[model samples]
Structure formats: C-alpha cells, structure tokens
Target: MIFRSLADIEALERTPCEQAIAARTTYGLIERAARLHGARDAFVYLPDGELDTAPQRITYAELLANVNRAANLFRSLGVGPDDSVAILAPNIPSTQYALWGAQVAGRACPINFMLQPEHVAGLLDAANAKVVVAFGEHAQLDVAGAVRRIPGIEQRQVLWVSAPGAPTPALSQRANEAVFEQALAAQPDSLQFDPRLSPERIASLFHTGGTTGAPKLVQHTHGNEAHTSWFAHMFYGFDENTVEINGFPLFHVAGAFVYGLAMLAIGATQVLPTVLGMRDAAFLRNYWKFCEREKVGALACVPTILAGLCNQPVDADIASVKVAYTGGSPLPTELADRFEKATGIPVRNILGMTECSGLVSIEPLHAPRVPGSAGLRMPYSEVKIREDGVVALRGPHVSPGYTDAARNAGMFEDGWLVSGDLGRIDAQGYLHVTGRAKDVIIRGSHNIDPQLVEDAFLAHPGVAMCAVVAEPDAHSGEVAMAFVTLKPGASIAGDALLAEVAPRVYERPAIPRRVVVIDTLPVTAIGKVYKPALRLRAIEIKLQELFASQADGREIVVTAKERGSAAVADVRIAGAEDPALAARLQAALGAIAVPVAFSFS
Candidate 1:
C-alpha cells in the first residue's frame, strides 16, 4: 500500500485542457486526479480517536462524491463564490470537505482553534465568515467568545461535528444551530459540483501567526491553490500509492495546503490519527505501530515530533519510509543526524511560512545537507535573504497579501514576500535560519541575537532544546536568559552549561544571565517553539519570583507617591526593560543576579 521514495511515485499523464473550456479558469486538479485514480484509496483515518484498529479507507471516487456533497450542503446553506466559510479543526477526513467545499463554493478560511478568543474573533471578522464548520466542544468554546465580539456574525449557524461520547456543550444548543450530521442528511450523497471560479479570484485565506499584532490572513487565489499543490506534487515526488501520513494540524498551511491537498492532488492515500497532537509518547507509540502495520511510506513531521521519535526506543516498520521532511521549525542538526542513524532514512529540513502556503524551500533528496540549513529552494520558486537577514520569496504559489493593509504592506516588499525570519544562504544555496527577527534580544548596547545564543547552546551535546529571550535586569536594560531542555541521561548544571557556551560566543558579557532547566519548550502546530510564549512565561517568573524574592524585597516597598510608579515599573520590568542597561552597567541582572543597588531612591 505504501510507495516509498520518489522512484515509487507514479506520475499521472496530464490531461489536455478541453478546447471549449481551454481559456476558462479550471482549477480541476483534484477532480482530474480523482477521475484518473477512481478506485485507488485517496484518504484513510481511524474510525475512532483512541483505537489501534485498521484505518478506514476511501477511494478517490468516494472522495469526489463527498466533496460534491460538501459543496451541495454549503450551497444549500446559501454558501457561494466570494462568500467565506470558516473551518476550525485538526487534521481529519472532514477537514478536506471544508477546504474543498470552499474551493467549490468560494473562499475558505482555516482558523487555528489553538488561538485565544480575541485572536479567533479577529480572524472571523476579517474573513467575514457566514458559516462555521467545527468540532462540537472545542468549536463551541472557541467560537462563543469570538462570536460575542462580532455581533453581526450569527453564532446559531455553527455546524457541530458530532464526536462519539462527547456531548454538545450547553452553550451550543440553539434552535437556529445545525449539527454536521443534520447538514449531511439534507445533502445528496452524490452530486456534481461545478462552481464558476476565476484563477485570480480569492479561493482561500490562510491566517499566519503575526509577530507584533494579531494573525494576518494570506489570500490564495484558485490558481495559487492549484499551483501550490502541483509544486508540492513535484517537490515531494508523490506517486499513486504513497502512504502519506497526515499528522500536522489541518488549520495551518503545512497541513491544509501542502501535505493534505497535495496528497489528494497526486492520488495518494493519506493516513491520519483520530486526534491532533500525536507527538506524545502513547500517541506516537500507537502512530508508529500503525505505520508499521500499514507500511506508511512518507511522513511530513515537525522537528518536535522528530525529536520525540528519536528520544524513544522504537522499532516500527519505518522501513517503508524513504523521505521524512520536517518543517515549521528548524530541525536540530543533532536530532536530524540521530533520526537518520536510527531509521536509516534521510530527514530533510523544510522552511516556509504560512504566507508562502508552506514548502517554499526544502532539502532535496540525496543532497549534501548543511548542519542547520533547510535545503535549497523548491522548483518554480526563488528564495533570497535580505540585508537585514529576512527570508524573501516570490513564486506562482505565493499568496498575494493579507486582508489588513498594514499587515500586507509589512509582509511584502516590491512583490517579494518578506518573511520576517533571519537566515543565511550558504555557497551551496542551502538556507540556515539564524533566528526570528522578532525574537532578537538587545542587551545594553550590544544586540544579543537569540539565534546566536541558541546556536551556542545547540553546539553543546547535553542540551537537547533551547530558547533564548531577553529578561529584564536593573543593571543591563535586558539580559539573555536561556530556557533549556537537556538530553536523556545528560545532567549539567547552570554554570557548566554556561561554560560550554561561553568560549564560542563573542559576547562574553552577553552570555545568558541565567539558564533555567525546563522539562520541555512550548511549540506551535508546525514544531516551531513558541518563543514569545516562553518569553512571556520567563518575564512572569522574573517579576513574581525572580525579582520578588530579592534581598531588598522590603526595600522595593514604595512610598504612597511611588506606589503607582513602582507598580508600573514592576509590570514593565516583568515584560521588558530598556536595552541600554547592559552597557550602562557592567553586570547584567538575571533571575539570580540581583542588583546590589536595589533602591530607586
């Protein structure tokens, strides 16, 4: 069932465009694939969330029919071209319907359910969604807060995906509301869906995580969507029988646009776990076992998942795996080496943002990989690093811009999508991402780039994972603080870990003021560590515990006049400090290094 490697990938003969409609816009890539591979399995998923039983498979014919049904159901609900429908769920068979239905109807906005309520509301309002398709409990909880903010959007029309044994929340019970099953019942099981679409028309809005403000929505045209899938088909070199594993969240571009849709475009069968976040021990164990049983061919996993897979002692039927592409985060050199050593499969790192619809660049097969590079640009794509260390890309598959003008303006420069990620392009053209532009830490007069600090820690054998952020110090405006997750059987204290990194780094004084030992770092759906979240958490520690537990704890007590000022200062210090302090004061303030002069008086 699993076709391993690009050699095993079957290439479908391109069907000549019908002369009558040759000039018309036809994003019929999926439809053509379905027709060519009618009897072949197109998608597979477990019937239940927690089960080891064989996956239930659906052929391309059934997939086409289901997509048609989904289109019909959306049309029945008054959905049409230009109207936006929102889907908030994990990687599942149903996600395909929501997405493809969008293409058949109008534009679909795949909103990340993991976002906070206000963030969710912002996207819903931006997309101007009419119908929302989501899981029962999670959707109700997420949308309830979002719908409250946007009074114009009705909360009653939500279609709850009824999960077994899970009750619809009391908040979701309403007369105008409709469940997914009810909607499907009204939809014809088989119907031909032929919606008029233009190649340049907006087909999907992919929301990406923002650095400064709320998430920005990336507009993908019908042509761009198909082009992206075609590019992925060529990049992955998918064949007819590729056992594609669908584990990343479908809400994101990597899951929804790249792997999920690309697999369908190539007539490949996709296997997905019943639930999201399968990187945990128990879930991964079950996943690998299933892969062995099903003989999965390829997996597009995140760096975090790959690390977990390497951490554990597993011997599954990974023999079918030919290429394992890890993206959404920089795959650690050590982890990639370990994975290749263990499974004897190349784990190529991929780098792209949601703006590019994912897979803008990737390490090609049999190519000599640089230690930390994410490989060369994919076919039909051009990648370049700007003078400011930003990754910029331009290609047919690239999205135009987001809904917000300000965001769009910042995202693109002279038509090139300027990814705010900092990276270096080597002589061989492999890209080595140094760090995120936003994650940079300014220490005193020196710019203590987090990527530089992280790379220093990465060189150490004991350090498994690390994130560097600016922590407030009274002396230095801000000092670098490193949160580290150690490797198994590796024990190194703060001083020892600091010593390992001290020699290699140029900023001797800019060395991490303190290294906090953490069990694990927070990661987004794509495996990129959520450094902002970690930085926020670290700031809280510095405020309530690190700064609060100072010897002058009482000395920090303010007069009635200074009370308000002190409270504001405390809050400011908790989050960030003036970047001028490090140079002003020779010694930096850290979680442990309390300033000797503790009084503002």
Candidate 2:
C-alpha cells in the first residue's frame, strides 16, 4: 500500500475500512503483530540518548506480554471498561505499556505532567481517573512531587514507575501506592478476562492543548485509533523492516498513535531517544549518528526539530534514511527545502489534530513534496474547505466529541470536525493550510493572514524561527507584529531585519507593524511556538505604550494573563486611583479584544 496520491488512498478505501483493517482495537492490532513477528524488535530505547550507549530492546512478543501484564494489573485494580487510567510519564517503555494496557482494560488518559499540579488534578478529576500510573522522581521533572500534590489522589490506586537503575524516591507510605514493577510482575502474562473490544468503545481521553480555555479532553474510540494508526502506517510505506526514531512525548497523539502505535502495529521498530525525549541536547546533537547506527529507515520529528537538524552536521552514514516526516506546527516552505537540500532525505509534511487521533493528512512517502501543502487527506475521510476557508473533516478516525460536550460547540459541526485551520484543497486534492482561522490579524475590516508575515521574515537567512501575532492597536483594533529568533552566530538589528523583509510581504496590511528579536521563542512541550504567550506579550506592550502618557509620573505596570478562557490585561497604577484617569484608560483599552482591569497601588 504505497500511497503516492489521493487516488491510491481512495483505491484502498474501496474495500471499506471495516474490511481493510483486520484488527479494530489497539490490543488486537498488537496481538496480530506479535503473532506474525514475534522475534522482531518492537522498540529500541536509548537510556541516556547517547549513540554509544547500550540500548534496551523489546521484541514484539515481549511487548505484547508486557501489555497483557499491565492490562491485567489495571483490571485487578478495579479499572473497568468505562474507568480511566491516568498516566504521567515521559517516553519510557513503561509509559507505552501503561498507555496501551489501559486502553485494553479501560480508558487511558495521558496527561501532560509538565502542567501545574492543579491543572493536572483538574484533568484527572474530569476523566474520573480511578488509577494513576506515574513516573518516580527524576532530576529533569518532579513527577513524584506532582503526583503527591494532586488532591484526593491518595484515595485512588497509584503505581509508580522508575527507569531501570534509577533510585526510587522516598515518600510517606500510603496504602494505595505500590511500585509499578512489583505490581506488574505479579500479574499474569496474558489477558485474564475478555476485553469486549468494540469499535465504538472509548479507548482513550486525550487532552487538547487549546490556547485560551481549560484544555478539552478528546475521546478517541478504538475505531478512531485503529483507523488512524493503520492509515498512517500505510501512508508512511512502513513494513516489518521499517525503523523510525521517535522522541515525541506519549501524551501527544503524534507520539502515541501516529509515529508510535503506527510503527508498532506492523512490528516496525521505533527508537526511543530517552526519558527527556527530543529536549535532550546531547541526543539531538548525536541524532543522525544514532539513526545511522540503528539503520533507521524513517525519521519522525516536528518542524522545529527539522529546523534544528538543518544546523546539525550529518556526520554519519545516513544512507538508510529514506525520508523525514514533520508536523505539530506549520511547516515553513523555506525550512523544509533547506533541510532537504542539506540532507538528501526528502521532508514530508503531516497535518494532524487530537480530535482525529492525531492524523488528518500526511504527505505519502512515495509522493513528491508539494510546496505550501500539508498533503492529502486520510483514506475514506472527507475533507472540505468551507466558504470561510475553515478546513472540516469527517471520517472514521474522527473522535465522537470532547469529554466536555460544551467545548465541542464550534469544533464538531454535524458529522464534521472543524479544524479551525484556514486551508484550500487544490484541484489535485492537496490541502494547503494557509493559516489558523483564529490567528488571522484583523485591521479595521481587513483580514490579514499571519503566515504571510511569518513567511516573509523566515525568508531571511539570519532568522531561525519566526512567529507573527496580532498586536492590540486602538486605531485599527489589531495589527500584525512579528517575533523572531535568529540562527546561531547570526546577528541583525530588528529594524534592519524588518526593513529587509517587509517588502517581501505582498499584502500591505499583512506586513508586520514591528519586529521583535528575542533569544528564544516560547514553545510548548513538543516545540510548537506558543502563540498565546506571544499574543499576551503583544497586548502588554500595547497597553504599556497606551498608558505611558496618562501615568503622569505615576508608575504604570501592565501584565497580561488568561482569566478562564479570556485574555485579561491588568493595569496597576503606583499612586491613589483617579476616577478621571481610570475612566480615560478604560475607554481607550475597551477598543482592544483583551479585557482590561485597573488597579491602584
């Protein structure tokens, strides 16, 4: 099933998804792989993320046995088909066991442990987690401390997992807590009860990382995960011989399903970098060497990692590498071209969302790169660009809705899940994502695409990463502003950089009003530029400039933060409050989208 175009995908779908995919559940899929490729390596884990380090290998049969043991352990802990088992860990083998095992026993809820304890607690509470599988204390992250902080967590069964050779952190003895290895070892190495596997049964609850609101938990059915993983494996042209380097965190769909489970379903080996994953600087430095050593046939990464790889020297025999896949953020045309030119491996783009089990479209390995295109939609999936340019998709891969039905209002329309991304389908069926619908900069009545400004800035050789956001403006409601980070050893004045790139932005309104150069752009755990933070910075800057004259020697401080799902700007005055000045400031700030609050010191 070498998917070269939409026609190939359509041809495959002609058999019907139910008939095409033999295994409908994650557990069933792994069982099939284990039966077919029992001796094949399923995973190669690099403990220290070093090329010379001795790696831990797990065979397909071994992996399936571990999954069964973990599932039995969870079921023994009273986790039912409707119960949720929450996991807080990095990219360790135990994390994978917990993820798939919980899916077999109950619903797996993989939370971002990097989030604050209160936020994590909220997610756990939302999912009604009955058991928690968390990592023990590590130097990089205080997972143990976070777990202890979760209110009422002591009431639920807690299993702590520690990497081999890592010391267990001492904590107050709790009756509900137990060592994960000890508990898992006690369980049978096979399923003790029927899974009652069904396509409609909820398999997992994935928290969506929205910019403003409390994160929404997406419900992925067994069918959703099965379809997405199968299609991704087909599109990537993966077989038992395919080996990919996957460092993405398990909490993300790209890591758990797209790049992770997709490879595992076919007994393809996935090289897990380390517990820290891609964030380990040393591992990134030796990424190519490790790939060369593993004979990796496919490279799994995000656009940010790909951009960094462009700077890293390919000092190893990477002849086995056929192609590199990147997603998570918009793939800049310039960045992709530069990487492909620097390394002979072709760079393919993937467009995904949590709602669709992390996949929507992927550029087939056999297809040539299409500039500015995210690639073709999944097989048997319907992708339509609304009149307003919002991409909407309906397919077996699509999740039913969010755990909180209210959050699905604008997201899930009819049977289609609105992507919130502005895109167009070409005559050839390629989807070119122009920009985020919400990210569009509005000036007066004109709408400006931020990608236009970002692409212009990225064209400069000195720029490493560039993000364009809307800055609050009293005159035009909001105007475009660019935040850029320069490449290593590259130096240029912000004004000079703007002067050089402004003309390249064809749209007058799309041209950024100002450019700010920073040492590094704030990014998410997965390295996508955190635009909400930049937007807040932009709003704070505008507020400071707007109130500077009105301060009249009184110290003026402006701070911005998300209040509930709304962005709020807090203005503090040094002296006693003056009603006249407060009224004036309130009237001026009212023009902006963000709500403004006044306070006096």
Candidate 3:
C-alpha cells in the first residue's frame, strides 16, 4: 500500500501501461462505470444563489447516455481523434458532460474563461481547435467576445451552453453558433465509442507558463490521465461511497482532470458549488455547514481555499472528511497545522504541474507528514533532483513533451521532465520544494533563496502569507524583498515585524532589506503565489528609492542588466554636486558592496 523506496515502486508495476490499462481505457472506464453503477448518482449540481431550487443530479448511466449524445454531436461537427474541442464555460453539469464527450471523440481543450480574447485566440490556434463550446454569458467576462475572436472559427463551430435557469440564447438567429441542448437533442442516445485508442493518443491539451513569456500547450494522453486517476484512487482510497466537493474552476487542469474527470473515473459522486467557488462569500460562509449536509468524505482543495476556510470559525469538528488534498503551490506548515486543528481535516499538500499531467507526489494520507514537504513520489513515477536542485521526474504520467517545439529544449532531457521548481529529496525521500531556481536574489557573490526568507517571515505569529522576491540594489547588485499579509485583524507594523525576523535570518545577505505589508498576495488560478508580478513590483520600488537617494541630488538615468539570477543596476550621474555620490550610493544599497559601477549621463 506504501512505497518506501524505488524498489518498492518498481515492484508495483507489471508491464507498466500495458497492464495498467488492460481493464480500462479512458472512455471505456466510463462505459464500465455506467453499466456497473447505473443507479448511483455520479454528479450533483448544487445551487449558487438560489437555494430554493433542488440540486440537479445525474446517474452514472444518464451521464454516459448524455455524453454519448454529445459525442455524436461533436463528430457531426468534424471533431475526431487528435482534433481539439475547445471549451469555455463555468462549472456546470453540462460542461462536465461536454468534457467527457469531447474526449470520447477527440482531445479536450478547456480554456480559462477569465482569459482575454487575444489569449483565447492564441490557445485555439495552438491547439488547432476544430470547435469551441462556451456559455452565453458571464458576470465578470465577455464570453461572446472571446468566442468571436478565436481566429477563423465560424458560428457553426461554436456550441453555446446555457446557464441553469437562464432562457436559451437565440443561437439560430445568429448563423455562427448553435444551442448545445438543441444540437444534442437531434443526436441519438447512444454513439459508438472507439475502444481502440492507443495509450499514446492525446487526450487533453493544457497550457503551462513559459520561462520567458507565452504559455506552452502541454499534451496529456489517455495514458497520462488514466495513470494519474488510478494514482488518485490508490492514494485517496476512493470508492463508490466517496463523495467529493470540488471548488477549483472547471477550466483548470486540476479541476477538469483531477477533481471532475478523475472523480467520475472512480465512480464517485461530485458536488459543485454555486457559480463562484472560493470567492463566493456565501459559499465560503457556509462551507462547513454545506459539507456536513452533503456528507462530503473528501474535499478537493488548494492552499488558498484552505487558508481562507481556516479564517472562518467552525462550530464543531466533522469526522466525515477522510482527507483534503492541496496542491498547485507550497503549503505553509503553519497553515496546514492550523487548518487541521480548526476543522480536523488533514491537508495533504501535493506537488505537480500541467506538464506532469496532474500530480507526481503528495503528503501520504496515512503516514506522518513532513512539515514542509509535498510528499513521497507516487509509485507510478520516478523523481530526481538535477545537479542544480531542480526537481526532475520520469513517469508514464508525464506528458509527451509540449506541442511547441521551441519550448522543449532544456525542458526535458533524456526521460526526465525538467520541473522549474528548485527542491531536494530529503533523507527520508520526501520532496521538499525550496523555491524556483530562477526566482533567487543574487547579492554581490551570494545567492539568496527567497523561500528561505519567506519562511522566516511566515514564522511570525501575525503573518498569514508572504512572498520574498529580488530587488535591484545600487550597492549589493540585488537584495531580498518581502511582501506579506497578516492574520485577520492583526495590527503588527511592517518595520517592527521586519526587526523581529531580521536577526532570525541565518545570513546577513539572505535577510530581506525591504518589507511591505499588503492585505493579500496575488495568487494564480491554481492557488500558487504569482511571483513574476511580485518581482516586477520589487524592481519598481528599489529603483524609485535609488532615484531619490542620489548624494548630489543630480539627474541620473538607471537601467537594469540581469545576468543569471542577479539583477545589476547601472547608474549614470550628471551634474553631480558631490564627488562622494557613487560612494554614498554604494553605502545605501546594502551592508555588503554590490557589483555596481557609475558613468556620466
């Protein structure tokens, strides 16, 4: 049941994918579940604002029947294997069926509904999407405009799904788009599903961030998805009696694959929240009450949601929750400990990325957790840290590289997927993620890891969350800067909090020179800290201070030259009133002299 070493992992695999998929193809799994558990409820669409309406439920057999109908409709639109069926919709039962239907006929590609039209257009083009399924309206975004902007897509290629109670949009009046239910109503209840799909045939298209800029479209095969689902089953001990409430958005890989698709894959029931999930104040306000009412056995979670829920008071500990798995970012030790104490549900902080399908490792549900570690590598996968400490993995679950050939270089080497995360395998073989290798701050000759600095701040009793980033310094080349948030109603001042943590830092160069207290840290859809934005803010604040402290009060021009992880500042001084301007600047940068030089404007 547990793998303590690589040998134990190897012993668990018999002919790997061959035996793994012997009884279950991705679509075949659906057929087996429907036939086996025809009467069992597979999904329940809980109301958002209208609690007066009863939750709409779907049985396994009904789900498969609808998926088949939807699949036939997709085929009528020329969707086939390797073809992309782009999805843009909120978390709804029909959207879930559309996901399964798309995969039954072709690859499923769900774009973040929050994306701009241009971003959606790029994703559609990248996938060479044949069709797009989207909602008619949304409160925060223009779904119609995004659909319009996908290059070369016709109205006929768009399938518009309606909201729960909203009247169907007049798709017929518009020549370009069609109503989803109307199109599916025209198709027969059953459509032939090809059971001959090779494990290597692509099953889904998901985008992950690039080192320099644009996101890369990751290719996950049926084999990749199925393997991870099986891992989820084994890791969580999922069974037909299992009921899970998924809060992640449907478009996210974690939601589409793990919480939604994977839940169905295991023949378990899924309960959806109202439109907005974690952000829905009503939902968050009544989360514990809802869980108790629904008999939620395992809650799919992220650190952000877990942190938010921890702030809300709990009346009593509910013993029904088996475990709450959180991934997509580092889980602070304090947050995990606090959450368990508050609600009695263990947070299994997980580690994975889009490129690796979903999850590679997570805290063992039954074992003692490492305070700051993600967990041991899953039995289906193998992980190694590169010489530079970047966690690298080799597994059947790992995607077959990205579609963009330009992004493959240095991204994968030999058989290992080169994760950008900097981490180390502990003596016990648990993976402890340190920080991103590229996000380090270089002070003179010393490299300061931001996570180390962040950990120092998180230890403060008042600090709820924190992010440490590199700021360009006129003296020390670069200095570590921290942005932090406090526990609700905690009134600790910024400088006082910094003083408490500064001496606690192991090294002088590693200590953050600047600390800014903010209400909250910017988070990605998947709940990870958005660090690139933090890095940009750090540079702006550091440069503004440099411009203010010119000893001669002279006009100066400054530019940043980034070499490796270091941020180098070149200052040009003109009409300098004091000869000690350069010296004064050097003294002000940091305690240690930076790799700074001066010139005339």
Candidate 1 local lDDT, residue 55? 60
* lDDT, residue 154, model 2: 79
Could you give me the TM-score of model 2 versus the true structure? 0.97
lDDT of 3 at 264: 76
Consecutive 10-residue window with the lowest summed lDDT within model 2:
163-172
Query: lDDT tens string, model 1, 53-132?
Result: 55667788877777777778887777778678888766666667767876677778887766665677677778877788
Residue range with the least summed lDDT across 10 consecutive positions in model 3: 1-10
Better of 2 and 3 by lDDT: 2
The digit string of per-residue lDDT tens for model 2 on 253-307 reads: 9999989889888889999988888888889889889988999999888877887
* Counted clashes in each candidate structure: 6, 0, 5
* Candidate 1 Cα lDDT to native: 0.67
lDDT per residue, candidate 3, 1-601, as tens digits? 4444434455677546556542334676777778888888888777563345577788999889888988888888888887889888777777877887888788888888666676777889889788889877655335766666665656338888876666675554556578887888888889865535767888888877722246679888887877776656655667878999887777677787667667777689988775665666777777777777778888888776777777888753456788888888778777888788888887787887788778878666666667889887876678998888898998878888889877788887887998888888888778999877788788888988777777788778788888888876656777888999888989887888999999877688898887999888888765667887677667656754665665456777656554454445676778634447777776666643335567765
TM-score of each: 0.82, 0.97, 0.88
Error of 3 at 389 (Å): 1.6
Model 1 / residue 547 / CA error / Å: 4.1
Query: Clashing residue pairs, candidate 2?
Result: none
